[model samples]
Target: MAVTQVKVDATEARLAAIPAPDKGAAWIEAARDAARARLREMGLPGRRDEYWKFTRPDSLTAPEAPAAALFEMGEPQVFDGFDRVKLVFVDGVFDADSSDDPALAGVEIERLATAAQTDIHWARETYGILEARGQTPVPRPLAALNTACAGDGVLIRATARAEKPISLIYRHESKTSDAYLHHVIRVESGAELTLLENGPAAARFNKVMEVDIADGGRFNHVRAQGRDHERRAATHIFARLGAEAVFKSFTMTVNGQMTRNECVVEMAGDDAVAHVAGAAMGDGDFHDDDTVFVTHDAERCESRQVFKKVLRGGAVGVFQGKILVKAGAQKTDGYQISQSLLLDGDSQFLAKPELEIYADDVVCSHGSTTGAIDADTLYYLRSRGLPKAEATDLLVLSFLAEAVEEIEDDALRNEVTARLGAWLARRRG
Candidate 1:
């Protein structure tokens, strides 16, 4: 592929920030080199790029993280009720002193920094493999940058059903901190595990997670990104599923100056299931984007893409989703929906929904809608003696119900709802 001069310069500028020395084991060093080459070839994203035309990449691609005021964390933390092992990161750096020992929870877990030092490790198979594959059809330069220069992360191997979930908590302390993190998760055959994430990591954050699920394995992920009203983040999740495996993930984004969340999945085994969903609420100076791609490469596979957004106070929201069914993938079931509830005329929503199919016997559908709250419902609630602000908050929750329902666990689902409600309440006039 021919490269542009502007892209080349930007890629080099970002690459220069990372140290030039090789500091990891042979495998990790090789992986990072490969990712560097890919990044060089693709270059940093620009507004002219097809996938990034809606949101500006200037703040995210700048040499340093833009300054952002820290929000107070006085409220109750999300997922505090779950009996899970916690891994903490402050300003994108791992906080070993404040984190729990990673040896618990029916899983073998290790930090990427430590695991990469070993000459032989299972992480070599996945560290940057999936992210590299996801680049095609669409170039994700930020993800490649993460693969090449991730400072800290985790490697989790689930051998059996975990008795407790594993939670990753991120905290922002500096006014201008930039962070990059990459995580790899492998669920062995017939195993089950739950992964939970919350908090805003830094002024600017770039993260990537690669998941590989073996036959009959199940992986569930629930994340909350919020409370920090002024922040920037670009995150990616790349997943591969084996026969009879299940992969489900949902993210709720509460606050950010700008955020882009991308998920790419490939179902290579028959009867595999993959579902990715998210709910985001944006206020003043906020811009959020959710981009997803799912490919069905085997027979009898199922996939879903559900996303909801609530925008107010001149906020902007964007969604780009696509599902592709391979030629021989018979009995494929693909569903996609992206909806936005615009609270005022000042806010905006942009969506690009697509479906490409090579199979004749597949069930695939996609729909996108942008609208305001139901006036009739609001009137009914107000007539029942509910305050106008409270009624609107109730309606906003109802609008986001579909995406939240994608969370399979009842307790976790309710916790997300409560967090979202609190955000709406705080923003209500």
Candidate 2:
């Protein structure tokens, strides 16, 4: 195949226009410099890039934020009943007046911007390191851009089991705010922490989160990307797991004009387990994409990718997931499934599932399916005297239950379910 070379003049100009990172600690400045160099070489992804072919990058790469009206939040917040340490950001800047103190018994938390102004910390080593490591095989220039320019986020280290979950809540009050944020999390050996995020941060957002799990550590992440009809965002999560570590992440997205979520996992130690799942719903000019990559480099590691999207009224959904098992990583177990339910004929779903294994004793499977609601099942629900809209919503919830079930915490799962239900109710009304 002949390779097509893209013109770099425009891309180079955009990279040059991005403001340099604010002066910080020496190590942070060094890291940003390295990331900026890498991003310049790789350039921003365009329509021709194989990985970004399904979704256009125009909205995401624009110099100014696409016009997005601030959405009035109506439904009860996710995890309303839970007692947790809250860190709040308004327009992508840390709001200390609205947020709790960054002090927890078992976990040490600091604002990345504040920490960079003080002495060196552990986050200096972790910030953007995994994103740098994930640059091979495929380049993630958006993540690299975030690493180079992000102005605010949090750094968390867990030394013991956390007494309560930590919540990062974002509020979008500006119509043209462009926000870039990066978060680094480290779960030490035998430590556990649950991280929760809920927000519509800005009109345009770029985010990167890097997590490092030591031996026997466990990390749970659950997020609900907020409902804003004109918002656009590109977010990436890079994680590396040590021996016997556990990593689980789940996300629910509703009503964004464009959202692209990329999750990359490297199982670098034996007996480690990782699972990532998402359930998204879109209606009328909405576009949502979930791209995930998992690599197994150690023996007896397990990984799974599950995603489901419901689209209606010309909405577009895309899923691209792959699992790779390296040579000599015997007994690797991998599973992946991406499915979509199109409520109307005009809606569309695109999926690409791949599995590449070099080990002989590995068990790997992947599948993708796109279809409308089951006619028979719809009929059964309608026969029970449910309205057509209610019946359809019921079926949608049933289709998403599999992905939602991956959330291990019962209360959090219920909260997510309620949020989904509320979204459906609003749509039906």
Candidate 3:
């Protein structure tokens, strides 16, 4: 494919601002070279792109990160009480002094920088491999750029069920930090792994996470991005699922200047299951976007995508989701829904939901909606002696319940609910 002149210039300008990192092992260097070549061919995403029409990519593709003021956190971080191996990153650099020992985690945990130094490693087979696959049918130039230039991240392989979750904590310390991170996770057959992520990574953050789940393997993930009002970010997740494998991921977002989150999944084995869900709340000048694509290539596969957003005070939200069932992918069951709750008329929500099927026996459905808070429900709550604001907050939580329910862990679910509830309450106060 020929790259557009505007995109070429945009891509070039971004690279010019970023310094090249140490090329690690032979395989790592080869992967980075391939990614750079891919970026040149694809260029950067423009508003003209079909998928980017509703949301501008200017800040995400800019040559330099916009300055962001630090947030004065008033509450303890989410998931603070959970027991897990915590890895900390400040301005995209790993912080060993604040992080827990990786040895304490059951899975094989190695920093990407460390693993890339070795001549051979388990990550060599999968790094940037899935992201490359995800590019076709849709060009994700930012992800390709990340693969080519990311300086550090983590590589994890789970050979057995991990007793506790692995948490990645990102802290934005600099006003102009531009950070790129790439992560690879492999779940061996019959093994299980859970990942938890939170925090505002940087003034401008770009991240890519690639996951490969073997037959009968299971991978669970939950993420929270928020509390930084002026930050801008773009993130992507590419996953491949094997026979009977299970993959579930959910995210909660709030209070960012602008953010775009994308997830791409391919189910290649029979009876594989994949679910992706998220909830985003934005106020004032905030904007959040969720883009997801899931493909069913094997028989009897099941996939679901559910996303909801709450917007107020002229905030904007966008959702783009698609489900594709290939030929011979009979009995494929896919469902998708994207909806938005507007707290006031000034807020806006844009959605595009799609389903493509080449199989005769597959069942697929998708729907999208945008609307203000329910008047009848609000009136009922207010009549019950609750203040108008309190009643409205209750309905907002109720509206977000489904997406929050996607989190399988009771504690995690409760924490998300409480955190969001607190945000709503504080805003009302």
Q: Model 3 segments beyond 4 Å from truth? A: none
Query: How many steric overlaps are in each model, in order?
Result: 0, 0, 0
Candidate 3 residue lDDT tens string, 45-147: 8888888988899989889888888776655888889999999888887888989898644589888878889997989989999999999789898999999
Ranking by TM-score: 3, 1, 2
Provide the overall lDDT of each model, using Cα atoms, as 2-decimal numbers: 0.91, 0.90, 0.91
lDDT of 1 by residue, 1-429 (tens): 777998898889888976543388999999999999999989899878888989899999987778888867775799988888999988777789988888765699998888878999999999999999899888899999999999579899999998889999998877647878899999999999999998888888899999999999999999999778777999999999999999999999987899999999999999999999999998878899999999999999999999999999999999999998989999999999999999999999999999999999999999999999999999999999999889999999999999999999999999999989987877773
Give the winner by lDDT: 2 or 3. Answer: 3
Off by over 4 Å in 1: 19-22
TM-score of each: 0.98, 0.97, 0.98
State the TM-score for model 3: 0.98
